[model samples]
Target chain A: MSKSILFGKTLAELNEICKQIGLPGFAGKQIAQWLYQKEVYSIAEMTNLSLKSRELLAQKYEVGLEAPIKVQVSADGTKKYLFQAKAGNFIETAMMPDNDRKTVCVSSQVGCKMGCLFCMTARQGFQSNLTAGEILNQYRSISEWAEITNLVYMGMGEPFDNIDEVLKSLEILTSDWGYALSPKRITVSTIGIIPGMKTFLEKSNCHLAVSMHTPFEEERKKLMPIEQVYSLEEVIEHIRAFDFGLQRRVSFEYIMFKGVNDTPRHVKELIRLLNGLRCRINLIRFHPIPDSPLQGSDDETIMEFKDTLNRKGIITTLRASRGQDIYAACGLLSTKELVKKQEKDY
Target chain B: MQSLNPVLITDSQPIANKAFLLQFNRTFIFKPGQIIGITTQKEIAPRLYSICSTPNDATVSILYTIKEDGVLTPQLSALKAGETIWITQPQGKFLFDGKPSWWIATGTGIAPFYSMFQSGQKPLKLIHGGRTQNDLYFHQEFQALTDYIKCCSQDSGNGIYAGRLTKYIDEQESLPPHINYYLCGSAEMVVDVRNLLIKKGAEYHQIITEIYF
Candidate 1:
């Protein structure tokens, strides 16, 4: 049977690894303890394991954790870490340290499938899902992990598209059996995966942030291709069923694209779409990626839009754009080093 | 230290929406009316969904609505049986203790009350306001929990006690003493209900609310 990149590995998979490495089957739990509990970087650091067992395990399946190869610091405190995927794909993860909390942006895939007209990764095209191990490494290897209080899936790939591995990683993160971070500290961003969105709402209790850049379908389709399949009207209608009236906050991610979707009429449509909903609108500053036709909306227009939403009784705030200097802003997350390496190999 | 006595509490589809029943483990010792935090799971940092399952129940559960064109709700809709998600220790101030109170809500803003109702304190009345029948979630629970007054504002469905929640509250001739008004759901509903509660001679502190975005 073929094994998954890193998912649904029952305790049996760990037992298989242990037995193959000449250790007792029960020793598998110890290995899990080291990997998920202690987060040991090197097999040599597994001092508690028998030397023979460590040697045997090292020969075949090395603890698959790699440190970040390159780190770029932006003028703002945002730091981007570049890592080589198992198959030589390049991926970038961002760490945004703030006053009250430090948030790390983790990528779900090497690239994405949504193909939003404006997103850089979409322009590059879709890649494979990051293994559960690969996804977890981004958190364990980041420089600010000690201070990191929050994580956002608003990085590179579409999280819902890679649901299995993503959910597995969450188990490790929240389970007393794993890292044990409260579910409250994590936020996932999606371009609207209807099927996946429903699962996430029922299965996960984390805060939900939707990338609702535009409430109008035609205009939204210009920026996000997913809008074609799942219309904005439909998305709002679906949301009308659940109650966000508790701590689980529902926030919409609105990226202001210069005069195109930043007019007064746009805000009116937004207010109408969100009229009865109890959610906040996060007005984001658009970061220009290479050769993208869209332009970032001017600050004045964004403020006006925000003002209109607030005036209409919707809670709206201008989200501070971070990591621009190091191409860590929205859609500017493709790793330059990885691109260069690919060119050299070609 | 977290205890490990997990229970499957209340699981029901509040609305015919694509949303699902929010399941929570009974690890955290929760009391009736205590709120909890829902964070992103370590693996996928999807946005958080604060649920309505307090620790007091045998199992914790909440109502959910899917987002059709939304990133979060759409992604969430894909869950299957036996898959685990992250949850935090219970934390919030929106639960209704045993008091004479009313909860005003609109849209999915009625979610948290699923947990509040299970938290064991029955209020005197719950004045619910929504646009249509599709908008009014948790009807049975509301019926069982307290004296419910339905207000369909935009007339999505007939047979609802017509008008706005604010209008409904204003028309009430007399309210019980020490009435604690709890408000959840839409931002407009909060502002409107809060103002109405004040006009009805309720103290500012007497009116507690969990303001949805």
Candidate 2:
């Protein structure tokens, strides 16, 4: 039997994996406890299984928990962990410790295909989609696994682009037979790929965060190329139509670029665009990447913009600049130094 | 996903090795660069393909290369004429505006440009990259354009450029910085070409890319 990683399988999938090798179906839950809750590094650590069953499983499967090959600690207590993908490409994950909530940002793909102009990941292009195991390993393999309170899919690649594995990881994370964490603590962010968003909304109860840089179509088109495919208007309309019950939240992420998106006019347009929506806007400070055509808005400008939006009754919050010294702009360190460029198909 | 409707295949012509032009009866209109999702079974999620046929054509055509391990394309290529397939209504914002621009593509990424060409919207130049001559899906049709260059890394002669598309562009003195550079290809191709173009003086806004996931 070919070896398969037993890290990120949902309860049903775990059941299937167990039954395929002639184990009792209930062993799936026991395995899930060891794999997710206990965060064991080896299948042998699953001591509840019979010695014979352990040998049977060890013949085919292993608890594949890969730790970060490299780590850079920011002065602000943000640690950027680098893990190698299955294809030998490197993916970055950031673990940020704030007050009481320790949020670990996970990447869904090795590199990203969505070429947002300001993103360093775009320059590296796309490498591959991470398996459900790869996504969860960023959370489980880290030393802070037990203390982590929230997980956000907001790192290297667009979460919605690799939706299946992302949803599977979510299922394993929240299933009572699995990690049994609250879905509200996990948020999946995207550049608003509608089909994936629709599927995610229908299937999962995780909070949704949309990266809406600008309200105007042409302006956004210049900022994020995804605007050309799924227009923000269509995305907003879709979000409006979907009923995200009170507990489920949808927030817009606006990365402030100096002269491009921060202005009185943009603030007004954003207000008009997001009117009547039970959502808030999160203004993020853009960290400048090498040869970037964009620069982050000055703090004074960002503060003024946030004030204007908040004064107008649109709740807006500015995200603190974390891990700047560590090049935490997701993909900066990996693409610049670590990525082993694979042979191109073309 | 948009609601899929059953459509009958009218013709399934093998254009190149492992590649085919599948034509189905057209019921609704679509823009030249728009894409439609297609699947052999209604219950399965349809894979998206650019509409390769012009709007006025009675039948809608899509050019696809068969991926041996792909869930949809293998079954799709094996499908014959008179077989029914499920397809979504044409929806995509990669719309063509008949602007004078450079169209860069590789493999079956040339589908959208072919539709635009068939629709009478000519590009200033069409630069297509393919590993082999067989990889160029519609080089013969594109020959009608004022400027059509085939960058074939494997295939030679026949007036084709003797290298990859990125190399061909690199050999040039300078690519025009003002005109639009529309690229449709794999993510690697798009990123590499876009970076090269930017390095060669073309501004970011002058470039538009549609990358396949």
Which structure among the candidates has the greatest TM-score? Answer: 2
**Each model's chain A TM-score:** 0.87, 0.97
List, for all models, the DockQ compared with the true complex: 0.01, 0.53
- Interface root-mean-square deviation of model 1 in angstroms is 19.9
lDDT of 2: 0.87
Q: In model 1, how large is the Cα lDDT of residue B26?
A: 63
- Among these predictions, the greatest lDDT belongs to 2
For model 2, residues B1-213, the per-residue Cα lDDT tens digits are 779999999999888888899999999988898888899998777878888899999999999989886788888888899999999888776766666699999987899889989898888889999988788887888889889999988778998898899999999997765699888988668878887887788877778877666
- Residue A174 of model 2: what lDDT? 92
DockQ of 1: 0.01
Estimate, for each residue in B102-191, the C-alpha lDDT of model 1 and write its tens digit: 766666566666566766656677777765555677776677754777787666444477677667778889767777766665433554
The regions of model 1 sitting more than 4 angstroms off are: A1-29, A48-59, A243-245, A330-335, A338-346, B1-213
Categorize the docking of model 2: medium
Query: Scored by Cα lDDT, where does model 1 land?
Result: 0.66
Cα lDDT, model 2, residue B146: 85
